[model samples]
Target: MELTKEQLAFFDTFGFIKLSGLLKADITWITEEFEAVFPMLEEKHDGSKRTMIVPFADQREKLCSLVDDPRIAGIAKSLLGDDFNYMGSDGNYYTGDTGWHRDGENRARRHVKIALYLDALDGSSGALRVIPGSHRLDDKFGVDVKRVSQSQTALHVAGPDVPAVALDVVPGDVLVFDHNLFHASFGGSTHRRMFTLNLCERFGEDALDELRAYILLHAHFKREHYYGSAMLRSAGPERRVHLEQVDALCGDYAERTKDLPELPLKALI
Candidate 1:
């Protein structure tokens, strides 16, 4: 299940790669789990706006084991190194258009997201679009793309009109991209089903403080722990490697966020 050298090169050069039907065989159960998770949440999606849950896969044992799946693990190992950390997961039911934006501007360590879209989509139907090579912030091209993307009105064009590659996908396809890559979606339905696994290169001791700060961002989701009980309970040695670093820091995370006031889901959105 390892990525071919050509595939690796494509991802490194363009900032994203789509592995079509990679999860086809497992999509049935995968979709079942996805549908099942929403009901377990305290808040329900009334279709007015986006609804999201953090630590999504951790809610179901089978989904938690997705990290250990060879297809997924191999991709992470290939892109971020064998010791990459599993940062977190999020499940979503999206509403309309999403403006072009990067998930992060990480200069210290490379981070990648593996996305699973549970329904069919194309450029005209809310498929993911990315500006090629925009992930490399250090590059001049990336810098200019970021500038133009942030100010589309200057060119008299709107978001969907921006020049980019549309990555059309179906139930079993997997889309992987750099965290710093600028991406957006357009013409989507109200209930677009999707989830993502976020992973990053293992941080060194020098970057522990930065890592902790990043963890605190989870407070936006009102998350006390980065992972759920099922994920922790189901992790074997192989899976534990990805979880250990963040697990060791949870004590500090809890203490720091203990006083943060809880807000309603819609308010957070």
Candidate 2:
């Protein structure tokens, strides 16, 4: 289940990699859990803007265990090391196009997203698109992309016209991409189902302040803990290694949010 050295190299160079049908056998259960989560929150996707539940997998035991799955853990360990931090999950019923953007503009930490798309898709049908090597900060190409893509005057084209790789996928496919990578999706149905597990390299004591800041940026989802109680209680030691770091640091979310503006209940796409 582990990625080969060459596969790792490909990711490091390209900013993403796709594993087709990697979770095919588990697709049935995964799909069921994916469907059950939204109902637990008493919210239904009405094919509107978007329906998102942060700490999505935390609502159900089966979904919580997704991060602990051997095949999934192997991918995280391969890229971010064994002591990676589990940065929570997001379940979505995606609507319309997602304009080009990176997750966190900070390029300091090694943050990666593992996306599980639950339907068939192609270049024109809401498939994920990524600009190759766009994650590199020092390269001229990356610099040009940052400059040109940011304004219509520079590129004179819309996001959908941007040059990129379209990653076509099916029910059981997994897509892992760098957080800095520029990505977007287009021409999709209103009720496209997908979920993501975010993981990143654990920070050292010297960099903990930076990590804390990153956690605060996303603290809108949690009340007191970064993860839900069900997610933590169901974890074994192996899974705890991934969840522990964020759990230890995110306890101050409520205190932090006291002075901040009110956050929307559901995350919009």
Candidate 3:
């Protein structure tokens, strides 16, 4: 399941790579599990805006095993390293278009996102679009793309019109990209189904604080821990390697966020 040298090079240079039908054989049960998770949550999508659930795959045992899947783990290990940490996941029902933006500006530790879309999509139907090499924040091309895309008006062009690669995909296709890469989607159905697995290089002693800060951001989802019970319970030694680091550092998350005002459920999106 490991990526080839050329695939690795493509990802390194362009910030993204698409593995068509990587999960095709398993898409049936995968989609079943995906549909089952939404009802287990407190909020539901009504086609008004986006509805998302954090630690998504963690909610179901079958979904939790996705991290243990060789195809997924291999990709993460290839891009970030064997000791990569699982940064949590989100399942979503998206409405309308998403403007260009980077998931995070993670200069210290490289992070990659593995996206699985449940429906067929293309450039005109909300496929993921990425500006190649935009993950290299240190480069001029990366800097210019970020600047212009962030403010569409500066280029006098709409988001969909921006120059980028549109990654069309159907159920089971996998899209992996660096967290710093600029990406967007346009002209999609109201209930486009998708979910993501975020993984990153394990933090060094010097970066533990930064890691803690990042873990704390999960509080916005009202999460007490990054991994749900099913996720932790299903992990064998191999999968445990990805969960342990974050689990060790998130012990006080609930105590730290206990007093924060409760947000409306919709705000969790």
Candidate 4:
């Protein structure tokens, strides 16, 4: 996608953008397709495997095609750099019963999320809550917030005054967010929430390997910050090797995105 100067500037400052109706006719189809392949996620604390299953069987291929859309992936590449990779996908429905947290440590690279809302999302409907521009805080923290899963009561620390933006996502709208941004969603009593996730630029050669390894050994990589419970974490060397193998599949993704023509939003509609 060709990002206007203002759009680019917004992402740099706010850490996310809600692009309306990003799904269109394919919304129901994609959701149904992904649900068919959705696996029961292990209730581990770490962020690994939490988003492992891609709805389409040929997930990597479909992602490449989707990301190549000029209005979508092209802009992602522009902000995230051309070395982007398709790291994982997730389907989430919130109860609004939970509070705040971040996905920093779970992601393997500098991550950005292409969140396509399949249905309307609002506070009452368990819509997403975000700390805008949280992504920009990474450099100051001495750690990439993307890699930090815990900050000891950071949820409470974030407090109530932190302005909570209720996303009014029409079906087909897409939201691009920095993975490190501090955001959370409440659950809906009815209507399932669905979205496609993409992570850009694999920083380390062994990043995927590390993920695969962690998953195999630990079955869960627990992150205590958000859940206030253990989610999942890596374990043992044998699993680490397995993680390496799984990571290999993603290695070529960056190369694939290099020269494609942009997919504009107008064409998508």
lDDT of 4 by residue, 31-147 (tens): 665554444343321322123333222333333345445566566667766555544454444222335555554444566777776667676575666777666654563243332
For all candidates, the clash counts are 0, 0, 0, 44
Model 3's C-alpha root-mean-square deviation from the true structure amounts to 1.6
- TM-score to native of every candidate shown: 0.95, 0.93, 0.95, 0.60
Worst 10 residues of 3 by lDDT: 260-269
Model 1, 1-269: lDDT tens digits are: 78999999998899999999999999999999999988865677877788887778988999998999999999999998898999989889998888889999999889999999999999989999999999999899877777656656666678888899999999999999999999999999989999999999999988887887888876554446778878889999999999998888888665676676543344225
Tell how far residue 113 is off in model 3, in angstroms.
0.3
Q: Give the TM-score of candidate 4.
A: 0.60
Better-scoring candidate (TM-score), 2 or 3: 3
Model 2's alpha-carbon lDDT is 0.84
lDDT of candidate 3 over 1-269, digit per residue (tens)? 78999999999899999999999999999999999988765567888999887778989999989898999999988888888999888889999899999998888889999999999999999999999999999898877887646565688788888888999999989999999999999999999999999999999978888888888875565457767889988889999999999889878877877775443365344
Q: Which ten residues in a row have the lowest lDDT in candidate 1?
A: 260-269
What does candidate 2's lDDT look like per residue over 1-269, in tens digits? 68999999999999999999999999999999899877755446778888888778887998888888889999999999988888988889999888888776546668999999999999899999999898886688777778535646777877788889999999999999998888999898998899999999988878887877877877654365668778999999998888777777766767886764332454564
lDDT of 3: 0.87
- Angstrom error of the Cα, residue 197, model 3: value is 0.2
Against the hidden true structure, what lDDT does model 4 obtain? 0.51
Which ten contiguous residues of candidate 2 have the minimum total lDDT?
260-269
Note the Cα lDDT for every prediction shown: 0.87, 0.84, 0.87, 0.51
Highest-scoring model, TM-score: 3
Give candidate 4 regions above 4 Å deviation. Answer: 38-64, 105-109, 138-161, 204-269
